[model samples]
Target: MEKTKDKRREKISVATEIDRLEERRARCQDNLERAEFRSRKEKLSEKERQELIDEMAIMNERVQQLDNELKMLRGENRRNMLLSVALLAISALFYYLFYFEEDL
Candidate 1:
């Protein structure tokens, strides 16, 4: 059904967003590593080191937000699938009780 297809599309879109955020998180981690290395090798000022740490913390927060969003979307998709199954079963029960009763 169109509704099921729409749900699938939405789930796929959410998964895609999660993947993008994961990739960005990986990049952020790489940057953080580089920044730490520079701070040790080149003797960054305290302010410069703190700035890098703050930036990494912000990136980590964004990654955590994406994880939470992914969890919520997955839960929604599961709920929709359960609802579709229940509806199908109820429709079948109705068909058997009413539509097929005349043939009996």
Candidate 2:
């Protein structure tokens, strides 16, 4: 029971963490888009343009990292679910095969 509860807690925390990462990813993407738009505008100093490019690059990198982390978390969640199911199946088999009374 405690293990199940802990798993539930972990699942909820992972979901919350993913939500935060997704929000950060969206913000980074929006910032990159805005920077791109600014770069496309009429005129800007070379330094300003370079700064915009740099900011976009950083944000892009952050978004990619968050995406990777999210994928890893999702994969972990799936593995945990599979493991739980397998354990439950094994316990059920044990209960039926070994724990049951034999009456002939």
Candidate 3:
């Protein structure tokens, strides 16, 4: 049915969005590691060091936000799965009552 197709599309979209956010988080983590290595390995002026620190802070915040978003999305996915199972069980019960009970 049309509603089923729409639900499927929404789920796929959410899954893709989650994947995109995870990839972005991975890139941010890589950047953080490189920045830390640079700070430890290179001698820089005070301004440059402070700028690096600020940049790292921003990236850290973004990573945290991404993690929160992923957690929310995963929880939503779990809820959807539970809803689908409940629906299937209800449908099966109805089918059995309507189609099989008369034969008994």
The lDDT values for all models are 0.75, 0.83, 0.91
Number of backbone-clashing residue pairs for each candidate, in the order shown:
0, 0, 0
Worst 10 residues of 1 by lDDT: 13-22
Error of 1 at 56 (Å): 0.6
Q: How many backbone clashes does candidate 2 have?
A: 0
Clashing pairs in 2: none
Between candidates 1 and 3, which one is better according to TM-score? Answer: 3
**Which 10-residue span in candidate 3 carries the lowest summed lDDT?**
8-17
Q: Highest TM-score: which candidate? A: 3
For residue 71, model 2's alpha carbon misses the true position, in angstroms, by 2.0
Identify the superior model by lDDT, candidate 1 or candidate 3: 3
**By descending TM-score, how would the candidates be arranged?**
3, 2, 1
Count of backbone collisions in candidate 1:
0
Q: What is the lDDT of residue 66 in candidate 3?
A: 93
Top lDDT prediction, candidate number: 3
State the displacement of the C-alpha of residue 53, model 2, in Å, after optimal TM-score superposition: 0.8
How far does residue 50 in candidate 1 sit from its true spot (Å)?
A: 1.2
Question: What TM-score fits each model?
Answer: 0.57, 0.68, 0.82
